[model samples]
Target: MTIASENTTVFDAVTIDRAVRLGTATLHEAAGRIGALPSQIARITPGQSFAGPAVTVSGPPADNLWLHRGLLASSLGDVMVVTVGGHHEAGYWGEVMAVAARSRGVAGVVIDGCVRDSDALANVGVPVFARGLCIRGTDKDPDGVGGVNEPLTLGDVVVYPGDLVVGDADGVVDLPAARVDEILDAADARIAKEARIMAALRRGETTVDLLDLPKETR
Candidate 1:
């Protein structure tokens, strides 16, 4: 079984709200594509979405002993960023854990493995993101070293605890805690620019001219 560090520093709640508004796609771009989770990882439910500082967990493959410990260690507004060393078959999480997470005000979960009881999890009400679903259960032996509140490598991305984690229909992306403000500023500019483009579209402006492309005879 794995465990967590004693450190509990979290990102600002207000900043998390602001980043959530930007959405994963926007933050992905704003962060220069440096922190997006693997593409294979997707939301278990269509509308599940949230943003917060991550509580990173690295567990043994095919084992969930670390999951329970991670849950106990998590805090309000914490997003569980679980790395299972790419174990994609076993269902390491399920409905019961969802309920446990919600009781503590945990925002959501993103696992580099599978989660079961999708239907039952709906009742628990915490957003979950994972590679997919599985019916397999995990062994309950919390008897090994696990990493919590530490940096984790999940698929193609590396997530650090306290980094901003955002999830939406587009998928989950982690933004460095230190870069949150800078990226939010960029996201705000992008949003404003899109508003102008949308207004131009409603007024019948062609994409060619709106983007200042050189005029050409077709």
Candidate 2:
């Protein structure tokens, strides 16, 4: 059920569901603890959590024209992954955009910038993961430098269109589309191992004994 566009294969629904179930923390660990978005970017709306393929967008600081374009170009179940020069003061997104994203079936939005209309966005029910909330409005300048469906860097991560994006209370993690299957398998194994460790702990085992850590010296 994968869809291809511009030589990129969007992850299928099955893969997205599996990743959502595995969650960002487990997937991040399974991917060798890489692919974490900046800690400043976090789930903004109430109960906000989502997993989907990225629809990458980049725009000039304090401008949102390209974000609109990205939303329009996105398909059902795509997450709008946006980078706006790491600007944090302007409200590049809000309630209106959340409604539009919902109409387009965009699963969520992860922006390395601020957003506004916090209450309305929460009611709109489109998951929004953003850097912060700002009331300063952004300009829809037509001449602003921007791009949609292109690779964009957020923090130290280079997010590509069609890459798997999983976000939750713990924060967002980007997984390479090609490595999703392997990562998921590794996550399952990690979960099983953790379960065993938890069981051992319940049986009165100590972390130093179970994990073979060095003993504390007086």
Estimate the Cα RMSD of every predicted model relative to the unseen true structure: 2.3, 3.3
Clashes of each: 3, 0
lDDT of 2 by residue, 1-218 (tens): 11224424567778878888888999999999989999999989978789988898888899998888888788788899988877789999998889999998989999999999998999997899999999998888888888887788988999988888999999999999889999999999999999999999999999999999989877
Best by TM-score: 2
Clash pairs detected, candidate 2: none
Instruction: Find the 10 residues in a row with the least total lDDT in model 1.
Output: 1-10
Question: Which regions of candidate 2 deviate over 4 angstroms?
Answer: 1-8
Question: What lDDT would each prediction earn against the true structure?
Answer: 0.84, 0.88
TM-scores of all models? 0.91, 0.94
Model 2 residue 90 lDDT score? 95
